[model samples]
Target: MENLKDEQQNHHQPVKIDLSGSSFWAKKGLKSLEANGARVDVYWDFRQAKFSNFPEPSSGFYVSLVSQNATILTIGDLKNEALKRTKKNPSATEAALVSKQEHVHGKRVFYTRTAFGGGESRQENEVVIETSLSGPSDPEMWITVDGVPAIRIMNLNWRFRGNEVVTVSDGVSLEIFWDVHDWLFETSGSSSGLFVFKPKAGFESKSLSFNGRYGDGEGEDHDVEDDDSSPKYCHVLYAVKV
Candidate 1:
């Protein structure tokens, strides 16, 4: 009886440790993303440009639909690319996170959870954290960015709740605007509709070949017709530097 009581006590005790070293993300500031998944010889060339933190605690992670009926969700961590991999035989609610930093440079932190049966049994939405951060999911442990709570999730379909106020991991902030509509692509002859985030002023969007296509791919180049008279921008390139 005594051994059982002691074991129960130890299991129930809150596990506390210095989060500064553990999977803790930047509370604020700038972030740089290095491409590590590709060949090291060409990593730098294929490196993604640095991006600014949205300045709030948020779950504003990004996802790319790699193929029909499949999506690749990511937290934007670049140092250890494998840190985002989903473990084998993971449960339906598999929660994993990574946190790292260096004195000379800012840190990259992130976490993700895959719930197989959450979305009406037809579709599934993955939750992600795009910044290096650490903390339990408790209301008392609220996170703040620029003195205000961060905008975490931007579900255009009104699926997720509880994270109503967006939160920035460190210095990242995202503006939320969404519209629902239907469209068709002539290339694949597939019809799909989804939401997209348009980065704030001064931030640029680059196209990345998720699965097929290559550098100088069609639509990668941007041009404005002389009659339209709109500002012409450079083509968004998407080739792995590796």
Candidate 2:
């Protein structure tokens, strides 16, 4: 797991807890630690965890973080199992996933899964990004959600940096932004594209404007005054063509 934080501050370093295999520590079943000055108890069972190309597991596991007698963060599909093992009620102010940053390596197509909406209505959708950077035809890009083409950009060399709004589900929509200047202009083969997916409900007003860049680079930095009121969901994907 990475950046396990509480309500007050963010933890920079990742905390690795081996929950799989028959190792001595893994058999102990529970691990206790401190993050951001808060006591956190971690409960996990990844013996049957399923994974794809990503390092994170897809399903068949549970990782729960409990603090102050409440389950603050729970990951995986086995939420009930995590709650049963932790013996704690879900926190009233549960920690929300604010943003996810992924570095994906692919030649033409990049695949990822993301959940849209909040609470009981939240649904996970398959996200696929396909680009034709060097072909007989003009360069183009296609972004699909749940097997449906959400956005298609033609003549990508000219329209490399832009944003669009697409509906993902009945009531859920996403404001997608893309910046592929490096992929088209960089002579060095180490080119990557930046794609930002933000929920279209109250996200623009809550979050700062995206400056068409990712990570540490030359850009004007905008600070959010109220951390508590900031948008709680954003997905930033760095697609590196190899």
Per-candidate RMSD vs. true structure? 23.8, 6.6
RMSD of 2: 6.6
> Where does the lowest 10-residue lDDT sum fall in candidate 1?
233-242
Superposed by TM-score, candidate 2 places the C-alpha of residue 99 at a distance from the truth, in angstroms, of 2.6
lDDT scores in order: 0.23, 0.69
Off by over 4 Å in 1: 1-165, 183-189, 198-242
Q: In model 2, what lDDT does residue 3 have? A: 37
lDDT by residue (14-103, candidate 2, tens digit) is 443434345325622677778779998878787888886445667788778788887777777888878778889864343445566667
lDDT (tens digit, per residue) of candidate 1 on 1-242? 00011243443222111223222243222222323342111111113334333221123232111212221222233323322322212111211221111111112212222211112121212222232122443112122333355444333224211212132343332222211111211234322222222222222333322243222223332221122221211111111110
**Model 1, residue 223: displacement in angstroms?**
12
Instruction: Provide the clashing-pair count of each candidate structure.
Output: 29, 0
Clashing residue pairs for model 2: none
In candidate 1, position 184 carries an lDDT of 14
